[model samples]
Target: MEQGQAPNGLSSCYRHPGVETGVRCTRCERPICPDCMVGASVGFQCPECVRNGSGTGHGPDAARPRNIAGGAIAGGDRQLVTKVLIGINLLVFLGGLFFSGLVDELVLIGLAFDPELFRVVGVADGEWYRLLTAVFLHQEVWHVGFNMIGLWVLGGPLEAALGRVRYLALYLLSGLAGSALTYAIVAPNQPSLGASGAVFGLMGATFVLFRRLRYDLRPVLGLIVLNVLITVVFREVIAWEAHLGGLVAGAVIAYGMVSGPRGKRPLLQWGACALVLAATVVMVVMRTTALV
Candidate 1:
């Protein structure tokens, strides 16, 4: 017999008695078919074990450990989301290498004529997706390298601390906030692209997180000051507005995530993120109205 095949009627799947299987659930030790197997850190788990906390050796009533932001602490890779984000940016960067015109279509622009499209198109022209696509787009090696380094260094801790969902929300909202501010302030024809805004946002969030954990603030504070100085000095090259917007948005969101009463923590935390998102939308709408 094969490794996973059961002899005659020696073993059968618990969920499907007619089907024979040698594989057993790691948690409940019940024979399970491929359909009922759920991947786990160790071996496969049955549907029931996966649904409940039994796979972790805890009953439904067991109090699971939670991170600072009220997210359940689970085993396995903590920086999965961050890794995915980096992979996305790298894939986009690779695509740009092959498709030269991709940059024009994805780069952040309020209003401008695309040479490749040979038409006037931009955020004001209803292609608002550029704001987000531009977040993952990068052309130069140096540009992507610096941003990825920042992301890997800053994002891992943030994702582990805040949990994947909340950390992702913080990143996307901060990026959108940066884009909105850039659109509102920068010249309509001026094109901008990079993850600098999002990286700056992470820096801001880290500042708040350190404070919350009662860690020393001088290191983060100094870093922020240095970056601000760099932004000001290179205002012509860097989009200062984006950096400023992301920093403010990230700080505000982080404060909400880490602060407030424990009982109402989820409400207050998500409410704060919602407010930032709302504000970002308002900024974009206002800018679009003015431009169009």
Candidate 2:
């Protein structure tokens, strides 16, 4: 007799006697028809077991460890996107250290977004990717270190709350906004690079998120104030314009994310993000044209 044949010389599934099946449920060890089979880590499961949520594979919570400080505050399972961003920044910095040519061609002149590049080379030559590429360039160890620390401190919780997609959108948009503002107001030949703008964006997003939750806003606000003071005091060295632009963009995007229409929050949130990005692009075009 065949492996699935019954004593009566008939081959059939346990759930559907008329249908033949050789597959068995992993948990219940019962024959399962194709229609009733649910994919599992070890093996397929029957519809009954699947309905009961029985599976060897872990669910989302298990896959992503919850933050001990609660999902709102920092310190928890590291968000992958945040980690990747930091890693990229470090790699670029490291490359610049080892390869002088890399620093000259990619970091400073080519990748780093600057007013002159955007206005002259970028607009005329159509090399606009510098707007986003510049975010990864860091000239000094401290420059990358401080910005990375900020990213690590703020990114995990923000990623957890906003989710990976929205979190990334917020970061990139903030960076673009920051650079755009810098190009618009800074010296025509001034050069700006690094993730400081994006980091500032994270801080801004956290502030708005906490406010929405009705959490005490003093800590985040104080931190922002301190950073602002530092920017103001070091006006010549620091790109305060970029920081302010990032902060405003982040706060506005966070507001849209938290205050969107019910049941369509994701859609509205993404739409708001798109609008922010579009506005930044428009700013870039206008600034480039004016400079030209």
Candidate 3:
């Protein structure tokens, strides 16, 4: 059989062409179907992710030192979109404050969503725009500040890698996914807004990009787990479900976009993302609405 061809059973592995290879890479150890094997620096690597040098050394951004507390804030290089995003979030938050006296609470409420938005008729009756615009809204100054920091830390490197459009798509997709998850699972009645959903997606994208570049993820994995733990246990007012959903979706989409040797077509990848979003909407309607 040719190297790329699949085997019935008694055939050479996918990693090596004619050596009758059976071993696979340690991390994503798919059976090397006679075309995918490589010698590892330490144990052995999948031809897909063979990195030079020993595995012990400075990580991607080790040149900069982070204070113990500061490290939790964000990671990786900064960029223009991340900065502008932070500025916009801050400005809107401040504007909301000044208008609080003059404006009725419903004005702000109009910008957010309640359980009733997904009416029993499978429609977004009133607060439907929250599906998109809520990403830019925040109830508190500190909420905006924290989410902006998250966006800056996570968004810069991703936007640089993906250019502008792909990054923005991932951000919007992530936020929608988070909101959908909340509606479907946690609390449909809850009015949630913040960039944390998009922000968590950045971490997800970062992990995907780093892992693809063959960077070791011991430190990154530890911090991600710790943050998830903190969000769930120690924190209140944080939509942990939204963050969790966005993180998972972001990582998956990022990997599909920029990870591996071959890049997925942008439109195809986005179509799949839209499909997932639609599915989430269906689920939320099922959860929050009843048949007439």
Winner by lDDT: 1
Number of the predicted model whose TM-score against the real structure is largest: 1
Model 2 Cα displacement at 287 (Å)?
1.3
* Poorest stretch of ten by lDDT in candidate 3: 65-74
* Whole-model lDDT per candidate: 0.83, 0.70, 0.59
What digit string (tens of lDDT, one per residue) describes model 3 on residues 130-246?
555667777676777778877876787677656555677788888778776765655333456677778888888888766754457786687688779878884577778778878
Q: What is the lDDT of residue 146 in candidate 3?
A: 75
Please say which candidate is ahead in TM-score: 1 or 3. 1
Worst 10 residues of 2 by lDDT: 64-73
Model 1 alpha-carbon miss at residue 139, Å = 1.7
TM-score for each prediction? Answer: 0.78, 0.68, 0.62
Measure candidate 3: CA RMSD. 11.3
Write candidate 2's Cα lDDT for 1-292 as tens digits: 8666777754578767778765656444567778888764224667766665433235653333221111222344438899999999999898878876454344212222444333334321355666677778888988899999999988977887666667888999998888777766776555667788888999898898776544578999998999999899998988887898799889888877876333476676777788778878887777767766
Candidate 1 per-residue lDDT, tens place, 197-250, comes to: 888889999999887654578998998999899889988888888898889989
From the highest TM-score down, the ranking of the candidates is: 1, 2, 3
Candidate 1: regions farther than 4 A off: 1-62
